[model samples]
Target: MEIDFLLVGQGLAGTALSFRLMEKNLKCILIDTPLANNSSRIAAGLYNPVTGKKMVRTWMADYLFPEIEPFYEKLEEFLGKNFLIKKNIYRPFLSVEEQNEWMGHSSDPLLQPYFEKIHTQALYNEVNNPYGGIMLKNSGYLDINTLLDAYASYLIEKEMLMQEEYQEDFLEVTDLGIRYKEIKAKGIIYCNGLGAMNSKYFSNLPFAPVKGEILDIHQDFCPNVIINRGVFRISLPNGLQRVGSTYSWHDLDTGPTERGKRELLEKLEKLIFIENKKIIHHKSGIRPATKDRRPFLGKHPGLESVYIFNGFGAKGVSLVPYFSKIMVEFLLNGIEIQKEVNISRWNQT
Candidate 1:
């Protein structure tokens, strides 16, 4: 089979990129063995404007937020499902210093519009905070599972997606093009998430796949907003709240550990106002993070036709739309990748 593009993995990165390419009349095949343990599938897909311990706005939150909002909304229409949900972010101040730091950063004229002057007196959750925290006007969740399944189903219905995994041995490289199994393509794009660590074209990109666990509680006590206590709490669309996610780089195991459960429970119990909330599900997956924690995008320097669009880490909801478009433009045209995200920065031809 011949196609214009061959994509490995069906996570958000691959799905978004493939969707963009197919928009330009390109035919692509997505190869993957759906891992229930895959990070994108298990992620809470939370998008928060105010992030980090300092409680400052996320990097480029102003630009990225606006760009991502309409992108997910459009995907909802294309996929015939809702992918993005908007909500407020309630951030608890852990200390006086932290509160002061928020005061200092809040003065920035650039950040002023996003700053909340009135301290919220509302205690939606116990949150371990006696003093009320500030509320970010814009924050919310993306339905990663729904979007992934919908895209996978879309491809399957068209017979363009395969459930089988790819083995390198079957690949035959020639000056003509790259070949894997019976498929020949003008080029191959590696969007395999953490699996990209072993990719021949991009293995040296310094990926740090961090493992995180999220607990899904079936309780309705979860407010309509995402609550962040520096380390936890998120709101889901279906009235399910995700209190998580515990980050661990050393223990890269995908299995949901007893430690993760215990830790999450301990932290979550602090915010549960309702007495009888029940545990619904526990999911663990490793995010394909980079050393700088920025997304990795663009084509390989050595191989003109080869490319990558991975290393989204925990910000897939915020990062994918912006970079995915840049990547598609780079794939279709000779668009110069931003230096920060270009693949060539880590290596040379």
Candidate 2:
């Protein structure tokens, strides 16, 4: 069947892109291999205005943050599901000097939009924030798995999704477009996460895959808001807290390791005062990060109809919504992509 686009990988990138494409009245089909360890499914789905140890504003915070709530809320209404959770993020100061430093940052005009109240005392006695902390506004986590599952079911019911492994050998590129088995489309976009590494059309780009592990523990004393310090502790429903994310560039397998668990526990120990808790679940997934820490976007250099929309790394929850709109616009109207994220940036390397 002829369609406007054939999108591979129903992960966050593919999911968001498909929705954006169909919203524009473009006919699209999504193919996904359910066996693939989808990083989007396992992600904690936190979108913070401030990131990193230094706690600087995230890249494109102004543009990216504004689009998040509306985009997700609109999608929620369309799918008839509630998955967006808007909550505060409490980042405790590591020292008095850091607290003083943030007090000065509070007045900065650039940070005014996301800046909330800065506390001189601990917001919660249950948590280990003796040095006070900064409460950021417009920050929260998305229930990515819930959204993906709901969206997948919607796609299935609409007959727009195909659950099958996409093999390159079966693809035939014609003058009109591309054909993968019975599917014919005017163009194809690959949002298959790290699976892009196997594509002959765009494999030369740098893809630094990192393994990340998360744990769901039943900690009673965990704070209501997300606590960020050495590690991030996100309060979940049902008296469980999700603590995570150890970045390991060497061991790129999608398996939980004892070392990973130990690392998370040790880092978590410094942040919260939890002594004992039952480990509810352990999950691990590989993120498709890049060398320069930017997403891979735009069309393949050799093939006009082939495009890429992967490499969102740990920031997929925030990045995908904004970039997916750009991708759809670029595909449908030939609009130029952002220069930095464009795949052409890697042409010289």
Residue-wise C-alpha lDDT for candidate 1, range 1-349, written one tens digit per residue: 8999898889988888898899889999999887632888888888877777666678878778777878888888998998787877777676666666666666687776664553534465455555667777656788788888888889999999989877766766666678988899988888888787877767788898789998878775656667777345665656776788889989987589999889987776665556566688988888899998888888777676677889999988888887888888888888898888887777745
Off by over 4 Å in 2: 35-37
Candidate 1: regions farther than 4 A off:
95-109, 112-117, 120-125, 235-239, 272-275
Tens digits of per-residue lDDT for model 2, 1-349: 9899999999989989999999999999999977463798888999999989999999999899998999999989999998999888999888899899999988999998886889989888767788899999899999988888898899899898899888988888877889988988988999999989998987899999988999999887756678888788998876789999889999987689999999999998887776888889999999999989999999877776888999999999899999999888899888999888999998823
Per-candidate TM vs. native? 0.91, 0.97
Error of 1 at 62 (Å): 3.2
- Counting clashing residue pairs in each candidate, in order, gives 0, 0
lDDT of 2 at 292: 93
Backbone clashes in candidate 1 total 0
The CA lDDT at 190 in model 1 is: 84
